[model samples]
Structures are given as structure tokens and as C-alpha cells.
Target: MAVQGIVTAADRIRELDEINGGLADMLNHMGQAIKALGPNAQAGSDDLDARKEVFQEHSRAAYVCTQAFHARMKRQVYALEEAGIILAQAHIHSATSSAKHKQANNQPVQGQGGAPPVPPASEAEHITNGGLGNLDVGWLNSRGNKVGMEKEAELLQEAKILLEDELERRRGPAASAG
Candidate 1:
């Protein structure tokens, strides 16, 4: 747990450093863009260069810090991953041991004299209205009031009749016998 905490802290620090480095890069780009646009840009090359050098120094420092943080955090992550594997194996071993222990205990337990309790029955109930009491399959094909869907319902009914006629034509006894 302590190691996990340490690893978590290291991970956070690495993430923060990475974020800081990105922000620094963005700032550097903005600074260069501004210097490029301003009228006295060429005349102030020396001053701009000095400012650029300072920025470079800071950027390099940030990069070095991020790299170091990553290296350290990577080790911690590796250790944490290893610990997880070890912990999983330990749990498996403990579970098996517990199962054996339980079996040993249950040999005498033999529940109340002869056997364990039986489970209850599960009946699958039928539904109506599509579901209990609301089983309205009127919506199976559509949802429209008798007034509002008159045209659409007529078209659908005609379509269903057409489908039935087509199906019967294709599946008639003479068609199948051939």
C-alpha cells in the first residue's frame, strides 16, 4: 500500500511535469510568433536572441526534469505492476487453500443432519399487452391514432396484403411440389 502510494505520487509528478513541459513549449511558440510580427523585430534581434536564450535554457531544464521524472516513475510503475501480479497469485493460492479448508469443514457440517437446503422454483410468467396487462401489440407494426394514421395505416395494410399474396404465390402447393 505504501509502495502504491509512492507509485501514485510519482505518476502524478510525472504527469504534472509533462503538462508543464507542454505549456512551456506553447509559451515559447507564442513568444516567437509575437516577436516575428512586431515591427522592431529585426532591429531588436539581439534583445530577442537574449530572451530566446533564456527561454531555451528554461525549456532544456524542463525537458531534463520531465525525463528524470519519467524514468523514476517508470520504475515505480514496473514495481507496481509486478506487485499486482504477485498479489493476484497470492489471492489464487489463498482461495484454493480456503476452498480446501471449507471442504474439510463441510465434511462434518453436513447441514442439519442430512443435506443442504434446496433452491426455490423459478416460473417464467407470460405477458400480455406486449407485457403484463399492457400487452398492446397494436404498436408491433406502428403507433398511430385511428384518426392521425389513417392514410399511413391504409398504406401499411395494403402493403401487408401485398406481402401475403406474394408469399402465398411463392409458397403455394404447386410451387413447392415442383
Candidate 2:
């Protein structure tokens, strides 16, 4: 029964490892696709109005892609931690079972206890970041700030001003006469 339990935990750890690998591959593909967009990874145009629209579109695409990548990476980190815990428990269980079998056979056990040492409270803090320890929170906040309708409106306003100026220049005295 103990062997079966250990096998199950090992299988779970392997599955999680495979999932992490697949997620990494997926993230790499996403990065490649973003790079393929162009040198700027943004939309470009010669005209102000068109360029504004393209910029908004590009921003939305980039924001969505980045969010997805971050989410997946977070999940991967969580899965890795779960796998580690499972493997650790399996080890502890195997050690305890062996100690019990040795005692039953009147053999001396080697370790003081069949359990692992307790980690310090500081170590708990290290894992309590909710799998976001490696993430750049400030950068994400700045990116979030750049998203949504407000930024689009600001870009449109700038484009409108430029278009009006160009129109006035083209009209010259005719615009005032009309």
C-alpha cells in the first residue's frame, strides 16, 4: 500500500513536470509571434489617424498577450511547487515505512526520526508570494495603466489635433473666407 502511494505521488509529479514544460513552450511560441509582428512589435503607418488606430490595436494585442503569458507562468510556478511538495511527502512516507519495517524485523533504524526537518518561518515567507515572486509587479501595473479606453481616447485626441492643423494649413486663406 505504501509503495502504491509513492507511485501515485511520483506519477503526479511527472505529470506536473510535463505541464510546466508545455507551458514554457507555449510561452516561447507566444513571444515569437509577438516578435514576428515587426521590429517595433507595434502597428505602423504614414498617416496620423491610421497610425493612431493601429497603435491602439497593437497595444490591445500586446496587453492581452502579456496578461496571458503572465497567467500561464504563474500557473506553472504553482504546479512546480505542488510537485515538489508531493515528492517531499513521498520521500517522508517511504522513509517512515522503511523505519517501521526495520523495527518489526528487530533491526536498528539509522535516522533519529523518519520525518523531514521543519523548515524555518522565513522559508515560508519565501513561498508565500503566490507564485509571483519572479514577476515584476511594478511593470505589470504600468502596463495595466496604459490599457483601456482612456488611452485610446487620448491617442485619438492627439490625432484629431494634428489632422485639424494639417487641414488648416492646406486651406490657407480659403478656410477663413468660407
Per-residue lDDT tens digits for candidate 2, residues 1-178, read 2364344656656656765665566566555555544444444434555545555565566566567667766565555556553221222224466567667767666644754323333443454333344445676687774477788999999999999999989899887889
Off by over 4 Å in 2: 1-45, 85-178
Error of 2 at 77 (Å): 0.8
| lDDT (10s digit) by residue, model 1, range 21-45 | 7666656655665555555555556
Per TM-score, the best of the predicted structures is 2
Give every collision pair in model 1: 128-135, 129-134, 129-135, 129-136, 130-135
Candidate 1's error at 149, in angstroms?
Answer: 46
**What's the CA error at residue 33 for candidate 2, in Å?**
14
lDDT values, one for every candidate:
0.53, 0.56
What is the number of backbone collisions in each predicted candidate, taken in the order shown?
A: 5, 0
